[model samples]
Each structure stands twice: as C-alpha cells, then as structure tokens.
Target chain A: MSARPQVDPRGPRFAAWVTSAVLVAVLLTGWWPLLAAQVVVFAVGAFASLSAAPYSVLYRVLVAPRLGPTDEREDVAPLRFAQGVGFAFALVGTLGYAFGVPALGVVATAFALAAAFLNAAFGLCLGCETYLLLHRLPGSTRTVSDH
Target chain B: MTGALVALGTLLVAAVVGFALRARDGRVRAREDDTAARVPAEVRAALDAGARVTLVQLSTTFCAPCRQTRVLLSDLAARTDGLAHADVDLTDRPELAKALSVLRTPTTLAVDSRGVELLRVGGVPKRENLLAALAPHLPG
Candidate 1:
C-alpha cells in the first residue's frame, strides 16, 4: 500500500503580506488623516509580525516538540487572530487619521512598536496576555490559555 | 491635545511595564545547560578549513524569549567575524526539532572554524558570554 503524504495546514504565512498590501492601498487613496493612520497601523503590524520571532521559537522549542502532529491545529487560531487584529488596527487607524484623529493613530502605532520591541528583547506578548485577562472576566468562560 | 498626549504616554508606559515583567520572568527561568555536543565528521572538517561560525537558533510560536534570542543571535553574527546565523521555526518543522533534541526556545549552538560544536547555550545568552565562547576559535 502507498503511504499517504502528510499535509500540514496551519496559519497562512502570507497573512501579513496581504494586510500590508491593503494598508498600502488605503494609504494611496489620498485621504490625508486616514492615510497617515494607515501608515502608523501598517508600521505596527509589520513590526509585530517580525519581532514575534521569540514566540515562534518558543512554540517550536517547547510546545511542538511535546505535542506532536496534532499540535499544528492548535497554532492556527491564535496566529489568525493575531494577524486579523493587526489588519483591523491598520484599517481603524486609517479611518481615524482620515477623520483628522491622527493622535489615536499615532498611539496605536506606538503601541505596536513597543509590543514588537518587548517581544524581540524579552519574549512577551502584551496583546495575548491582555486578551487572556479580558477573557477571564466574569461571564466569559473562555480562557486566554485556550488559544 | 493633552488627552492625546496622555494616551500616547500611557501606551508607552504600558509597553515598558510589559517588557519589564517579561524580562524578570525570563531571567528567573533562564537555563544554565551548556554542554557542547559532538558534530558530524564532515561538519567538523569544514570548520577546521576556516569555515564561518554556524549559528543555529531553535524557537517556537507564542514564545517571547525565542524572539529576543533570535535578534541577539543575528546581531552577534553580524558583529563577529566569519559568523553566520540561521533560525529554525520549530512550529513549522516538528521533525527537525526532534532530530536536534531541542528542549527550549532560544537554544543556540555555535560551530567553530573547525565545524565542531564549540558551545550550546539555552536561553538568552549574555553578549559577553557569547563573545567569550567564540574567542577561542577565532583566527589569531
């Protein structure tokens, strides 16, 4: 009997690139404040994805080694969620900047940069941790650790 | 104006706090194992013939420490002479991780000029420690 080939289907690596392209498109639309916001948002998203090398390493070194084949599915949701948030932030920042709320966009960009630096230097994910804590509030049964 | 500035300041402060907390946790759980493993005969031979330093970094998804280690290793490789670094994402290749027997994120294996394994560092290695480890194998 012929052995079946193993197909690993986890989160898509091109998610960041797609989001970046969208942000660039929005920026090119010629909306002043929105374009500025998009810039900040895109910058944050890029840094977050690139700076997240530590978390990727941890998953490889600690989790994957122990979990085996099935663990691949476990990684998909979290990655997608993180990437989606990045896209959303960029979109919102663009909208805000377009509406003349550049400060909000700047804040978002700063937060993104800080998150990236933190993960790069110390191995921490403020967004993930915050998501977890929010999920733990009364009436919410889903824990951040579930991801 | 003040409100926006305050908000920005707050975000920066939160980032600093988050960074500090993670760093503290990282220091507490940092690994101390540093035994060099035997290199393959061919790899050793390549190193002895003046091959560049080979840096292998093992990492995982959702790991903060792994990211820091990658940056540090990349920076180290760039600054040092005849050093090259490659990172392996354990999430993408479970089999490779198994073959390498990686137990932690940020595990670094340094191969010297003789292609022999010179040192293995688990966790974030101090800049000085990494430099010192490579000093012996560097060409005089």
Candidate 2:
C-alpha cells in the first residue's frame, strides 16, 4: 500500500543465480537440511526487506562494486512476491525430503530451480509473471495502486 | 548417480523452457479480430492529440519488464511522427484487464484515433519487429 523501495535491477538477478545454485544442490543431494536452509533464505526475502536478504546483501557487498553503478532501478514489491513464491516451493521441497516423499521433493525443487534458472540466465521472472496473472484473475480484490 | 542425472535433466528442461519463452517474448502479432473492440476512454484520453496511432501499454505496479517496455515504447513514439505512447495501469482495474482480455502486464495494444484496435504485442516488443509491423499504419 505504501511506496516500495527501488533496488538495482541486477541485484535480484544475482540473487536468482545463487538461488539456482542452492536449488540445484537440493536436487542433487535431496538433502532436507539444505532445502530447509533455502526455505529460510526465501523467507527472509519474502517476509523481510528484499534488499536485506542474504544474496542481495552479497551482491551489494561483492558483486555490485565491481560493476558500474546503474541508474535503472526496479520496484521491490514484485521481487518480494517472487521470493514468497519460491519460499512456498522450497518449503514444500523440505517437507517432502523430510517426510520420505522424495518424489515430491524432487518435483518441487525442480520447479523452483527452473524458475530461478530462467531469471538468472534470461532475466525472465516467472514468479513475477505469475503474480501479475493472478492479479488479473476474476474476483481478485487486489489492485495495482495498492501494490 | 541418478541424483546427478535428475539434476542434469532439470537443467535441460529449464533451458528448453527458457529458450521457448525467449523465442516468444516481445514478438508482435496481428489481431484483426480486435479491430471491432473500442479502446477504453481512459486509454483514449492518454493518447496524444492529433496522433494517428497510439501504443497503449497495460502495466502494473510490480511489473519489472513493464518498466523496460515503457522506456522502449516511449522512445519509439517520440521518434516517430503521428505515433504516441500511452501506458494504462491495470493493477487497480482488473475489470478493465478482463474486458480487454489481457493475460499479462506490458501488453501493448496499437490503436488509432477512432479507438479501433490495430495490433497487439505481449511482453516487451522487439524494436525492429514492431517498427516493421507499424510501418504500413504509419505515415512517412
């Protein structure tokens, strides 16, 4: 409802790269702890300030300084929404791995990895797209102005 | 190991989807059926006076690529005569989106002064492709 902060557009992409890596680890190892850690990472980005998220912090500290400063900035709301989407997937993955449902774990992690990989490699934010589409669905009460 | 194979398969599947999306994004398509559809008053009001054609972009608050598309469409409009760019935010107006049958943000509808729909582009448009598509409708 309030004015959201703007961030360097590349920051989210960088975070997506890390997310892809983490998700790939989850898929390869089928490790519940690793997936749980990724869920926590997604939680921080979704529920807290996106700029303060772990991967964004790393980008700000290490990656951003090496690149020239860019005037183009992006709103944080969509990226935060995307993190929430990722959190849901990662949480499902963690539960699946922990509860002897390896198939669910693999499928969920693969889906998350697919999304993160798209963002990292091609700048396509599937979660953001999903948010927009959901907003356009019939009987939706949410509005762009309130976002 | 099967785990490595599964991971590799996941990466391959992601790559294929990414490529497919890349191929489809920003490609303009003709919509002759929408010729009968009238542009909304809000969209018409956003058009430049005396404009022959307007690129009406539907946008949302959190759409990142919409920002990039705005820059591209605005710059293109400024450089061309009788062409105008207007962006309508649909975040608060889901009914408008539904009425327009817009499935995504950054969907640009090219309409004439009479509010007749011309062409539409989903996602960010390819510059050369958009220019080529609009050439016949534009005055030299």
Which parts of model 2 have CA positions greater than 4 angstroms off?
Answer: A1-4, A136-147, B32-35, B40-45
| Span of ten consecutive residues with least summed lDDT in model 2 chain B | B31-40
Best model per TM-score: 2
**DockQ, candidate 2, vs. native dimer:** 0.60
Per-residue alpha-carbon lDDT of candidate 2 for residues A1-147, written as tens digits (9 for 90 to 100)? 226588889999999999999888877777789999999999888887787799999999999999999987888877887787788888888999999999898888988898899889988887665555677557442432242
DockQ of 1: 0.05
Model 2 alpha-carbon miss at residue A95, Å = 2.0
What TM-score fits each model? Answer: 0.36, 0.88
Superposition error at B56 for model 2 (Å): 0.7
Report lDDT (Cα) of residue A17, candidate 1: 32
